[model samples]
Target: MSTAISEAGNIPVNAATPVVTYSPVVFDVPGRAAPLEIKVSAPATGTDLPIILLSHGHGETNFIASLHGNAPMAGFYAAHGFVVVQPTHLDDKALGLRDSGHPEAPMFWRSRVTDMHFILDHLDEIEATVPGLAGRLDRDRIAAVGHSLGGHTTSMLLGSRVDDPEDPQTGDLSDPRIKVGVILASPGVSDEPTDGVMMQRVRMLRFINFDTMTTPALVVAGDKDLNENFSTRLSYRSDAYTHAPAPKTLLTMHGAEHIFGGITGFDTVETTDEDPERVATLRAMIWAYLRSALYPDDKAWPAAVEALESGAATSSGTVESK
Candidate 1:
């Protein structure tokens, strides 16, 4: 962890402050100058907080987890110890990850890739304007975590090899600025005929993030999840990892469903009663990923992941997410 922060504006320091939600900050990318939403978590105080860019999947995106109220699943990371921010892409729909354009890269190119790069740029902009946050944020230690389509965006950030690459800002997944790598309840990369394989037909490959990713990448999926589904997602993802040459790990929430990947699914006990095993798998994998990715030197994360693979936490905290 490095001691360096950038400025967007000078946010006041108030420890133990009640939750504060603000209107979304709309930003534009460089090339297309497309509009993107940047929502900041209200911090009580302190400059040393680590920042995380939370992204939503394809369909509908809620920057803050208001509808769903789970800590690790919701705004709890910010409450615990993280400067959380989520951006809404242009293509979010009522049906999660389902859009008319579907998997076409150009449909939401600006929203997915360009807007993402712009958000990072604004993190600097905010750091510039916010004196308190200056030197407080570990700029080089930033990490991105997303679910479903959001995970695809994160892959672009992590340097996945994409065939029909539309986002021009593709950079090294292991760039120094990013010290941690994470993928939540997302489908894996593919060479097979699975869901979300837009560039499958392509013979040439252009990486949005890239192969041989140097940053430790975490790939997670729900077992019973049928959104993009586990079989299709994992097949493509595992194949990519096998060939990429990067330090990576894969985790599956045994029998876990897809909806439980984000805040929405974790909102209520009644809403999450579909798959108990999957619920536990979601927590085990996501929790461990955070601990491991955020705190690389910590041994507990490895142990937790080990337990998940062994199928421990099967019925206790696990529930099916819709």
Candidate 2:
């Protein structure tokens, strides 16, 4: 990875440390159609480290939609003192279920949310599975982070309920175990017009409600990411931060796109906006936010907010918290 100096003229914490990764850690979910598989990554050496459960975005790219994607963020988080866990959701194209008559086809949004809970339920198995990782985790400190459809999953875990369109009843998938969340380029409002196959397949998108998303979260949106297909207005993507209650933050990247500088993978074609500096800023700010949120007495989040307000970080983005 290329290194970029932060406002303090030093390498960011994410890039300064090294990490160890273990993949294909299998865990069984009783009654689920298939077993859940995950990839775990952590700092080479650290005790009492926090945990970050990352969910990958849904797309046609089979591998990327699984735990294999988001290496950039996973590695960064792992290197910077967090044990990152990524799961391969049922919606992944790699399973070749598109043509099959599966019940939860297309988005499988509900299953995605449950996948996270399953991971949490089996943390003991995860620790035992990973060599040299037992007793090194801080179980009480846990956070969920996601992108795109995965962000929707994370939101549900953070108390965003979905109203069952047919039943008029809401589903509460929120997990009290998840202390904080971070949403990257997730769909907002869901008021956009739809037609053709997308209208029929992704009907669950309309029921997403952020009014009850009271969890402390950091919502990151790209100013230039005009996802017209998802919403009529670009600002619609910022609904997570806009609709959620206090203790929420919005980080608007000045000139970023959906991928936010190749966060899905290193130097991949999906990254429309490739700015190393912007990615570096994200690394520093997210690390700071996670640290401060997990440890209330920590001042990293406040100091980073001050830096952003004072034009100390080259004005890469604007931060607003409430």
- Candidate number achieving the greatest lDDT relative to the actual structure: 2
**For model 2, how does the per-residue alpha-carbon lDDT over 1-322 read when each residue is reduced to its tens digit?**
9665442212223344678899899877886657788999998897999999999998778589899998878888888889999999988889776556776777778888999998999999999999889999999999999998898889899988777668443578899999999998887766655522343457776667898998899999999887655666788668899988888999998898988876788777777888766676776778789889999998878787777666667547888889
Each candidate: what lDDT?
0.50, 0.82
Clash count list over all predictions: 32, 0
lDDT of 2 at 12: 29
What's the true lDDT of residue 292 in model 1?
A: 58
**Candidate 2 minimal-lDDT segment of 10 residues:** 7-16
Alpha-carbon RMSD, each predicted model: 9.4, 2.7
* Per-prediction TM-score to the true structure, in the order listed: 0.66, 0.92
